[model samples]
Target: MDSLRADAYLQHIGVPRPGTAGAAELRALHLGHQLVVPFENLSIHLGQDVPLREEALVEKIVDAGRGGFCYELNGAFGGLLAALGYEVTLMAARVFGEGGRLGPPYDHLALRVAAADGSGPWLADVGFGRHSHFPLLFDSRGEQSDPAGVFRLVETPEGDLDVLRDDAPQYRLERRPRQLADFEATCWWQRTSPKSHFRQSLVCSRLTEDGRVTLSGRTLVVTGSDGRQERELPEHEVLDAYRDHFSIVLDREPQVAPLDA
Candidate 1:
């Protein structure tokens, strides 16, 4: 990526350039990106191709002003961090799926960022929806608190670490380092398979200062510091909500598929 494109990414996330990539800088970047970009799989619902390449990911998220699921979001984020001279490794994780079952391998993409001061690695994930509001210390066993929830990482008997949010198991993370290409098959499955939630639901959501705003299918759900609100939107109103809330302007109404068991 060129310096110009890098500047565009910083602008997209509303972040000023950090002279050096440190833990504090990484934390700020993580929060800023999450606040600006959304966690959505609308492209999958719209039957659009979801590419896993860093350049394509950047084009969609930063250039095109769109959001994507884990692959696109984390892939792009990892690339940006790498460009900024941070020691970032793409790590694979298995998400806790329907019925509390663990999904297949490479179900998610996260980052292991080494501290600029050489303290240790920290888990920085901007792609997980409703997860920790900031990065969590990788080696710490104690509970870490964030605006999203209280999180704890515990080592399991199987040797993988389990990430728990508010005492609920979110996912078991493998320590093994992985490349972005390792997740390609799972990304394809998620976009195309009927069993995948990304293929079923149409949701576009982003974190707000107070709480969150989401458009699920035709329903607009908003939860703020004040309270929660939910209402069904008419077809025309749906597009308006996407534009107004998510800053996404769609050419046509997105096709939503039914969720499969």
Candidate 2:
């Protein structure tokens, strides 16, 4: 791997290139890149399917200058982080598929990275669409705070940990480390099936230093360190919001409609 090109992306996304991997530096780098490089599935809309291969993910994100959902986002970012000297492990999370049902394995791809002093591992992710603004301690049995929201890892009766955000149950975390290729089937479902939320809605979100913002369907919502705001937008306004708020230029705009529409 060419280190120069990797460094260039760090500069491209405005994350400082701190040669040594400190926890704080890695957190800042991840948060900054996430806010700048959005996660999108416009390819699915363009009649192009998202490939489960790592090379395809790197090509679209690092080479073609496009972003993607979990499989691509985590897979590519993990590669970059590994090259940047951060030891990363891929982990799977079953998604909360709509109607409050639990989906199958590999529905989501998150990361676990060993701490600077090697005091176990820490949970780090920027592709959940909506998650903490900073990394959470993996071994923590208590609540952790971030700019986006509060988080905690609570042990379940089955011995797996349930990661909660703002006391809201997000995903039940399995302690086992995994490989990116393990998520191939779920990626296929998310990209192709209507039962998947990723196939149903156009959602792009990220956490900033102070807070978070999310664009779901036709609505554009921004929440700062102080408060939250939600507004209804017209169809054309959705495109403008995508470009101006999320820093994405859509060649073919989404015909966004109300959730109830």
Candidate 3:
């Protein structure tokens, strides 16, 4: 990523270029990204191939004004952070599923960022839907409280870190750093495998000032301090909801592809 692209990414996320990349700046960028770029998996259903390369991810997210799942979101965000002088390392994680079973090797992608001001080594993840609003201290073992939830990083006997939210395990982080290409196979599996959850549903979600608004399939769900409200949208209104809520304009609404397709 170049200076021009970095500036464009910052503008796309509605954030200002920080004079120094530090903890505060990291928080702002993390939150700004969460608020602006949605966590979505529409490509798989839209019959679109999700390329894991940096240039393709940037074009889709920044230039095309679209959002993507973990690999694309963190991959692009990591690039922008590195371009802005942050020491960014792409890390692989295995998500914890039902009964605490760990998923595949590269089930998720996150960033271990060392800010320029020496305030970091923070776990910066903008792709996980409904996760911590800001970066979490990487080395902190105690519970870190955020508006999203109370999070804790527990070091396992194997030296891997288990990320927990509100006392529930989210995913396990490996110590080894990874390259964007390393996730290509699993990224392919995520989008193509019939068993993948992403292939089973369509989701587009973003954080709002007070809460969150999500479009899961055709059901629009809004949750805030007051409470939660959900309503199913007709086919005619689905495209408008995507535009109004996520700034994503699609000619046709993405539908779940046939299992054999």
Q: For candidate 3, what is the TM-score?
A: 0.98
Top candidate, metric lDDT: 3
Whole-model Cα lDDT of every candidate shown, in order: 0.87, 0.74, 0.94
- The residue-by-residue lDDT of candidate 3 on 51-132, one tens digit each, is 8899899999988899999999999999999998899999999999999999889999999999988986899999988899
Better of 1 and 3 by TM-score: 3
* Separate clash counts for every candidate: 0, 0, 0
Candidate 2 wrong stretches, greater than 4 Å: 97-100, 225-227, 255-261
Clashing residue pairs, backbone N/CA/C < 3 A, model 2: none
Ten-residue stretch with the least lDDT total in model 3: 192-201
Could you tell which candidate, 2 or 3, scores higher by lDDT? 3
Winner on TM-score (2 vs 3): 3
Q: Candidate 1, residues 71-144: lDDT per residue as tens digits?
A: 88888988888888888888888999778899989999988888676755889898988888788999999999
* TM-score of each candidate structure, all chains considered together: 0.96, 0.86, 0.98
Q: Please report the TM-score between candidate 2 and the true structure.
A: 0.86
